[model samples]
Target chain A: MEKIIVCIKGVPKPGSIKVDPETHTLKRENMELILNPNDRPALEMALRLKNTYNTEVVVISMGPPNVIPLLKYIYALGADQIILLSDRAFAGSDTLATSYVLAKAIEKLSPFSLVLMGLKSIDGETAQVPPETASLLGIPSLTNVKDLFMERGKWIAIREMDYGEEEIEVTPPIVASVSPLAFDYIRPPSLKRLLEVKTKEPLICQVKDLNLDPQRLGLQGSPTQVIEVFEKKIETKGLVLEGSPEELVEKLIEILKDKGLIKF
Target chain B: MFEKIKLEDLSKENILAYGEFYKGELNSSSLEILSPLKEIAQTLNKKLILVSLIGSLENIKDWEEIKKSLADEVWFVINEELKDFREDLYTEVLVKIVKFSQPYGFFFPATKIGMSLAPRVAGALQVGLCAHVNNLEVKDNQIIMARPTYGENIIAKLISKSIPIMATISLGAFGIKYGEKEPSIKEIIFPEDFVWKSKLKIRRFAPSKKKPTKLSTAKVIVAGGRGLKNKETFQKLFELANLLGAEVGATRPVCYEGWVEEERMIGISGVTVRPKVYIGFGISGALQHTVGMENSEFIIAVNTDKEAPLVKIANLALIGDAGKILELLLKNLSK
Candidate 1:
């Protein structure tokens, strides 16, 4: 059967992840991890395609060993196969290095017709991985994809651009990054599927499993290094005006006029 | 055939900026990077070359702006094959050009095309790229890039270990100014053996029927949040914006609520706008939403909660009902 690969990430629940006030660094440990909000649409799209086209939906994640539960949870959501790529060697990989590892994993699962992913992770929010990975795999990437369909066995995707929308027709072995704006509802977990997945485990892969160059696996492979990270504090002219809505509106109008924003 | 420059012989000294010339007009943001890049180039004693790939040479109408950009040189790869952007082919040609030019750094505007194209070129070259860079500094001959991460709550300073420190500059991060200079021009011809076809093809593109949002370029912005309640209440913000001749923006929640198009969402996940004046209605000022508009010259926020985070930083914080305030503001402005 033809296969579609959906790359997902387990991220901290929104507003649950906290930053260290003193060090200005993220405190990622011991936090609740949920499927990345952005990845929901990607998984949903893959599952829909699976239902419609009879394609196999293979979901892959790259994170720590703790990511297994998330993978198991995804399986309950209708993924045929779940794979976890976890290793100390994979730690601290930036977008490029991370995409390299993902591309390698995708290559290992060869003959797959499509690769799908979220345009940006909630934590990182750098919509770079999909394109970078596609480049490494020597395939075309359509990112921020709002809509996609198969026409006569050809892939047609409508992507959201800064200016407008673009419709593209692409060949197979292509990667697409789904936009969060595309799909709002991710199917809830089915009780029967969840119970079935309790006994199912993800196929785990470490550095030794994949034929990866040690020099290109983790921090050592990363080209950009974060020298410092700090909390951004904004200082503005604090002025509070409290009164009736009409009074406040009148004050604002006067201010706009003073600033030459409004003409008489 | 273009002469091949070997990687080993590359000096990696000059600075290069990607000049986005699409259709007939040069992107203003591409020119904006030149102001800061000019200073860096002067300090490093390196030539500042504006590199561009164009579909046709005769269609170029922004040559006057290029001439006054203070760039030391111009490099153009003019070909009919480039008429439509093909990611693979463009990445291949750009990788070849970077290999030949051997620049110490390359800057691209953080735009739709740049965001997509820059990473692919960086991937092909196996170089590090800092995305959405807010600022840059040259320290000890290394380009240090600063960018926001973690939902715009934290700013990270980074340095690239690889040559040709590539970065996509954030929109409106740098302002543009003209300097009189006659830059030498060079045209590049692709190698004879480089004839290649891309697997990706454009079926069609229907430009937005609505007027281009142009939020990034708007001098004034009137934004709304969930505090405005349902769609009907939110619609009043547009009337207020129209009277003020300002663009409309939204917080993530409001956008998710389907009050506005995703493009109008101003926050970490959406567009970052730094307008001359910004007014927010019913916004409680989450960091995710505030980061995108914090750089505005002046801010007026109308929220019921006086202690809201955005209220504390606003130039004028009006504590009142969001819907009521919006209604009143619209009535006053439309008069």
Candidate 2:
């Protein structure tokens, strides 16, 4: 049977993120954690493939111990097995460092035919890890994948290219970063399946377990650094126009002219 | 005292061209990218270059004007054989120019083309890239690129240690600024050896029957959200927009609830808008929905929720139901 790995991230719940007053850093304490919204589509895609092609879906994540609940949630969605790659050594890693650890994990879980991931994580929006991970593994990668189908043992996928859709066919061992738009089509887990998998324990692995280069798996491994961050304060209050229909149209034209957005 | 830096001073300066469509016209995001390119070029005293791989540069009417407006020189890799965008061909051209030019940084718009090309370009160059950047600045001799991460909730600043640092700017993040001094445009033709991979084939281009009404580029926008409660109430928002000659927009909830189409949603996931007058009706101003239009010149929010973040950001916060306030505003304006 073909094996597929879907990468998932545990992120702060929507509207629950808080910023520290003094440090301006994200305050994680007391925040509700859930699977990243984008990752849901990847998991859904993997589940669909598993149902159709008789495949095994493995959900993988790298985060703190608190992320196990998220793995359990993925299991509820029909993931056959779960891999939690957690360790203090992997903390504070940027996209580059994080991809390093995940690539090593993928290498450790070799013989897999496909890897699926969200185009980006809600927490990091860098959208770098998927392609970076693919590069590290020396495999062909596709991103912004909207549709996927299988024919004659090869995956036919529709990807959003620069201007429009480009359909490509690739054999297994390919990596894909799915877009968030695809999640709306996914079917939620049935209550029976949820209850059945709710009690299952996830398989946990650490950096040492993957046998990754200790120097290249965390903060010290990250080449890029965030020097400082400050909230942007808007200085311009802006122009307001109010009046009748014709008058408002005239006023809008004048403003656009002044701003050079248009010319008369 | 400010140090005098020469145009040849290649210490730590770079230009990123948000990938534009090869066929129809130059992407509007290119203009937005040029706004910062002008500022960065002046600050860093480095040459600005714009690169595009297209069927024919002759077809682009604004080619000369755009070249003169932004880059000190314009480079085009024209390939009739490469009319449509192929990842391999485009990536090959980008890698060649980046390696030869040796720029300190690169920029691409956070569009479909940009998101695809950026990571591959960075991978080919083996350097760090920051995607979907909202702000870019030169700080302490390093390019500080800020992008909203964590679902547009918190900003992440990334600094590259290697040269040719790449980033893709989110639409509507930076307003367009036209420089007083025009640029001198120079064009470089691509050599014949440009590689083309025909792995993907374009069947045809079926143009949209309804031309995309340029709502995001409108000077005035009147938007409604799920707070409107019903389709009948949502119609009044459009009536007001029509009366004001403004485009109609909706929040994610409005679109999700099927009150409006996805094209009308205004937010991080939707189109980014910077109208002159942005009036929000029955919208709670969620961050995902607000960031797209927060840069509007004048924001007037009407919502029952006094504590909504939209109300806090609005210049005029009317404390009442959207339907009631809109009716009163309409009647008052009719006089």
Please give, for every candidate in the order listed, the TM-score of chain B alone compared with the true chain B.
0.89, 0.84
In order, candidate lDDTs are 0.83, 0.71
Overlapping backbone residue pairs in candidate 1 total 0
Best-fitting candidate, measured by TM-score?
1
Local accuracy of candidate 2 as per-residue lDDT tens digits, A26-67? 555457888887788888989988998898998899887788
Query: Which candidate gets the maximum DockQ versus the true structure?
Result: 1
Q: DockQ for each of the predicted structures, in order?
A: 0.68, 0.25
Give the runs in model 1 whose Cα sits over 4 Å from its true position: A18-27, A260-264, B1-12, B267-269, B332-335
* Candidate 1 local Cα displacement, residue A149, angstroms: 2.7
Question: How does candidate 1 score on lDDT?
Answer: 0.83
Candidate 2, residues B1-335, lDDT tens digits: the string is: 11322223322245646437557487777777877766776688776666667776556667545644566655565657557765545776777777666786688877767776677677667677776676778876667877655564455677877677777777766666555556543334455554555434454444445556566788989899767778778878777776677888998767756677656778765678988888788898876777789888878776777677787788766656676666655664456
**Error in Å for residue B113 of model 1:** 1.3
What CAPRI grade goes to candidate 1?
medium
